[model samples]
Target: MFAGAAPLAAQFPSDSSEPLAHARELLRETPLVDGHNDLPWRVRELAAGDFDSLDIAVHQDSLHTDIPRLREGLVGAQFFVSYVPADLIGNGAARFALMQMDLIRRMVERYPETFVFVTTADGIESAHEAGKIAALTGLEGGHAIEGSLDVLRTFYDLGARYMTLTHWASHAWADAATDEPRHNGLSPFGELVVREMNRLGMLVDLSHVSDSTMMDAMRISEAPVIYSHSSARALDNHPRNVPDPILRRLSENDGIVMVNYSPTFISQEVRDWAVTRDSLVDSLRQAFTIVDVTAPDSMVVDTAGLRQAVAGWTETNPAPRAHLEQVADHIDHLAQVAGIDHVGFGSDYDGIDAIPQGLEDVSTFPAIVAELLRRGYSDEDVRKLLGQNFLRVLRGAEAVAERLQQEMDPIVATIPP
Candidate 1:
């Protein structure tokens, strides 16, 4: 249906690698839906939310994503993230989330020829058939709701298909993977949030939550949950990655864990190197404190000196580079533990600073497809990884929502002050 668009098979020349040519052919037939991307946040940070300032229609050297690269990647659909900082919990977080959501909407409006705003599994397919990319939105933190089910409902109405329960810090009702456990898991209100999300056909994303929180949400959610952007913890031991136990439970819960491409999450060596570097930087900061600290307990360090010290240390001890093979290893591990139907991709592109070697930008997705093919993955299995798995989960949530809406009322419970 794409007039003047090159035929799928003709996109690759005869000189292209056999696996790469095959990978591109497979992607054209199947919608390669990425679970998470932070282009909206990148635009907010770099362009002050002005699409004109950083036009994505052409190549953008400064960012990992743009329309040209996404087309090169053959990405059929993408979940544009409306990520609010964890610190915004009580201080107008809901408003900030609204602004981010509005930015996504504006993006669709501005690039109507290239993007089709989609909220359902079928919508993605429709967009793909029309040779346009489907643009969907996902909230990156539960803190964006500010502990209110009403706000959660409003976000779903605004087209948020999923929400990570927490970011780097634990909030009022949920524990974060990177923070001290306050709620242990989901608090009473957090459980209610999951239930309400199920009823609304919105996905319960467990990417940044603690293990306890993952277990709690998995046990409570009627709809299948998703790790919008995470890797396998069994491989790297990063708190941000999913453990084998959770991966095992995915089949029973009928959930999917979209493997992440972040270097720290994919490679154990890289993660360890980061930890040591951070410790060294912290020690260096202790010796060069700022003269005027505004907060009594805060120790502000001279950033210039810290940067120089870290640069020197990095020069001496270069960090290990994670590669495409390591990413495939994570995907292979997830499929081994969680089953093939539950494995998918959520590259965390534009959200992370460091990326795996070959998977440097959005255009590199075909390289992953080629890697998996070389590893003996059947085209059918690779198709599932590309987008079928996520489509199944999306439809599953929609089915559950249809059933729940007929039986239950909207949750109005609020967290007690």
Candidate 2:
């Protein structure tokens, strides 16, 4: 966006500091936290490797996340999602969920000097003060509980802080953005889930819910909610993006929607191109019938890979920095629609195939801060977007949980005579 202003050599003159030196300094001052990332699940999937030797290169070998990379980005806390695909939830999902959680806990326990497990806002603060990356867990889909509150409570007892009501598949309790519209919104049982979440002190995440379902959640939830990872529907009109009306409601209720970093959710052009690529792949598959892709063993069809392939695909066919700017555009839109306080960063690392340009992984996050600073955001405002807004929501969630738990005598009655 800062185009033709000055020559590169002039901007980074040997006689003077880099033009962005101040921005870089401020970035270090900011406490970076991401709302959702599936790195733990990915790590679990590849039990094929050693986790102890994980560094930036090994982390980025497959996707976004690794200890060294997180330190480079100054990421203070991360809500590593124990995400299991919806269909896998019933038979193996629950066990996988437990394994993923234990993996995260073990990771922190082994690296006590580099990481700390945090369950509360205060804990996050203390861990940050101790110079460690505070790790938190959020169940990406409600189905992980297997349609039982007992299991939900057990997950919470295991350090799960929040749960998205539904995933791509609709559950008995709620509809997903990708579901076939059985209930149109939350079911009666879904409302009960909301109340249960309220009583349990866990945040209800609306990232993958439909528009009607988002409103339903905001209306019924006793605590302020979060969209763990979503973008602006106004920009791309994808089901994954939230509309302004819902954004306004999130703002009113003091909730936060962590902006996602998926390229398909950012630009219609990228989405269209992805469609074209898929069609091409289909044609080739029909013609040859030997492995879906000919581009070696690692030919990812998603936009991120397509952007940088053997043909120099996305790299040669660059979708302007404006496509990336649209990320900030959503930030601006949310500030206008939901108030500046309600928007935060929730990059879908390890979960999505394509990342928007300029935001490939954890280390590139300072680039986002630099972009925001370039757009005239003050240092204070940037800090909130980075982590403070989410911490505030967590504090409010704690209060709401305490108040709501008082009204549920059954959970307390289970304490025995």
Candidate 3:
């Protein structure tokens, strides 16, 4: 455990009137399934995919997730993301994704007592009943499939329950929210990707996809879609967030928008600060004739000079802190817009660099639950937000897949030339 971190029992007091206590009791009964986390990526980065070197059995200060912290958070099920960067589109993206998936499976195998590898809704509940965290896999970028439906099916067979259509950059078929539009939304092959996923019971995750792509998938997918780690754009105005129109559409589609805790996505102030920082960095790069301004740290040749310049900028204009309340506010907005049954937590724990104040790490989940309780959310409503809603979506996808499999063959089409 990190220094000064309270013990699991101590984190929740015994006072009957305390919401934290109530929240703890509720989570004990209901599985708190987080839609996304990136512990596998962290393991791959820090230890070169060696779980023994970077042990999660005990507290590791460098990471946001650990076995002890997950237990304290009462996280019954977690989707460990196999995140391949957009830069790796055709350059062995599938291999990297497979490696990350292997890492998650190995983690589960390494700690059998703490985690149970689960690919179905029933498996999640069974693992939770047995007092184990259900470790599930998710593929973050569709580019990892290399424009092939067969590869997508293979990923599902390998235990990827959900696959985010795009990452930071748009690829051949899908348009990423952060990148310029190519196919305008999803190409013909992209629509087939959604259809194939529906037929295979894999949840279509729209977190980093563009608005058009999100709408197209929502229209094409027979199963309910999910923004696995997105906040309400009506709150923060970030492209990565779900807009009000999309939230309203969830009611008809019966999908869920798992709120993200990333400071830039949840806080308007933080979003604006990032915009200003990026603009300043770009201007500085132009002034210095730096070709690779993307490398923010020591990897670039302008390590010393650029660091000095950015350091001076930071000294004058420090970034504002994002509070826990701001995260709750986004959740509240999502519940209001998407309806109570359509919102849940997707705390992007290890995936994000900066976290909100109260939600510092995985163990801080109860704090958000307590905040919801304090804000007048009933126990039943809170239960839906915690995990029931996500499970319902998963079950919906499974049912859709079962029905579709009887009517359709595997999608064998390739990207059109």
Highest TM-score among the candidates is held by which one? 1
TM-score of candidate 3 relative to the true fold: 0.93
Better of 1 and 3 by lDDT: 1
lDDT of 1 by residue, 119-225 (tens): 99999999999999999999999999988898899999999999999999999999999999998899999999999999999999999999999999999999999
For model 2, residues 1-417, the per-residue Cα lDDT tens digits are 233324433444434434356555755665677899888877766653247545333445776888777877778889998886888746666776787788878777766778888889899888877778889998988777777777778988899998988889876667889778767898776777777887887899998887778889899987889999998888777887889888878866789989888888777677667677667556554444333365665434354433334245445655433345778777877777788788899988888877777777787777776666656566667778888999999999999888876766424112100
In model 3, the Cα lDDT at residue 218 comes to 94
lDDT of 3 at 230: 99
Model 1 clashing residue pairs (backbone):
none
The digit string of per-residue lDDT tens for model 3 on 149-241 reads 888899999999999999999999999999899988999889999999999999999999999999999999999999899999988999999
Off by over 4 Å in 3: 1-17, 290-301
Please report, in order, the local distance difference test score of every candidate based on alpha carbons.
Answer: 0.92, 0.76, 0.90
Quality of model 1 by C-alpha lDDT: 0.92
In TM-score terms, candidate 1 sits at 0.94
Off by over 4 Å in 1: 1-16, 293-300
